[model samples]
Target: MEWDLKVIDELPDYMKMAFLILYNFTNEMVFNDEMKRGDVPTSIQCYMHDTGISEDEAREHIKHLISESWKEMNNENGDHNSSFSKEFVHVCKNLGRASQFIYQYGDGHASQNTLSKDRIFKIIINPFPYKL
Candidate 1:
């Protein structure tokens, strides 16, 4: 079955653009497994185009929102123990770190055009010549 953007269109006009940007960003972060380093600028431009805000204002707001998200991630990774298993928490933290590493230079994983490609090839595509 084909997916649709109709649900997005159903949103109120004032919120549709912001929601679209968020949805795109989240999809890139989760499904793409990589993010272009230019995401912030792109997001700022998107917001400015959508809201008629100045570039500077859009950039400031986007950066502040990103900073807030980082703070939330940090809080989740903090030493406070919760009902979750320590291993699960560690995995979540490592996933965040791995995402940062993958996107450190560019959209390595999604584009398959960076050092990530080489690493993936070595680990998954090619195996040791000798059997265990």
Candidate 2:
């Protein structure tokens, strides 16, 4: 699609952090995008630098980000643009739901316990055993 990532640079560091949460989730679902350049520590430092917030404030901001991201991903609750297909909307919601679990434990992904390849396979490839 020749997408331009430069657009993401326009966002404030905290927002960029929030967007990365969704982006990382979506990228896991739909791979082959541009590789991430910066490390998590660098991103977090930028966020704190731009916001001038302490760790407690950062924690609250993270909570708010997670909530807002979930609402934004939801079709009925979010920006329900009619041009998007039902399946596409479902994928968006799925991304949010999956990330909600992943972020439940503080930065749980780095452990590689929750965000494992096997789990991705389960989410993408495994079909529910339903019968008519």
Candidate 3:
């Protein structure tokens, strides 16, 4: 039961989270054990992309990016559109997360911000393992 996009914005933050969890409740709760496979929290990944300097701090503000795109991941495919597969939400989330990561440091989208560019390059390009 999806509501209008604008209506979600009007909802309190907790309700916003409820909407998401309820939307994909069946997505298995994943944890790292022996199998080494799990559901990546792309929402949090996207949040980190927006503002995480290290892996320690992570976060989700995806709606505005694709204009109420949470609909695309409703565990069902559509005409000329594909479902995000509750657990994987796939490349659409990837693109949105990329956007979050790129712009997390304040308008770093164009790569004009030297500090942001360097941060991006260091974390993504010249990367080494993060310890904490």
**What are the Cα lDDT values of the candidates?**
0.51, 0.48, 0.41
Stretches of model 1 off by over 4 angstroms after superposition: 1-45, 55-57, 77-83, 109-132
- For model 3, the superposed segments whose C-alpha errors exceed 4 Å read 1-67, 70-89, 106-115, 129-132
Please write out the lDDT profile of model 2 over residues 1-132, one tens digit for every residue.
233457769853333444556654433322211224333343234456789987556545655665665554442433345565666555655655676464443233333445454555555577455678
| Clashing residue pairs in candidate 3 (N, C-alpha, C atoms within 3 angstroms) | 47-59, 49-101, 50-104
Candidate ordering by lDDT (highest first): 1, 2, 3
- Per-candidate Cα RMSD to the true structure, in Å, reads 9.2, 8.1, 16.6
Which stretches of candidate 2 lie above 4 Å from their native place? 1-43, 75-81, 102-109, 112-132
Candidate 1 vs candidate 2: which has greater lDDT?
1
Return the top candidate by lDDT: 1
Cα deviation of 75, candidate 1, in Å: 2.3
Residues 1-132, candidate 1: write the lDDT tens digits: 122467867743323333444443444333323234433335556677899998678767765775555555555543444565667666655554455554444344446556766655554578456677
Residue 129 miss distance in model 2 (angstroms) = 9.3
Say which prediction, candidate 2 or candidate 3, comes out ahead on TM-score: 2
Per-candidate TM equals 0.44, 0.48, 0.29
The prediction achieving the highest TM-score against the true structure is: 2
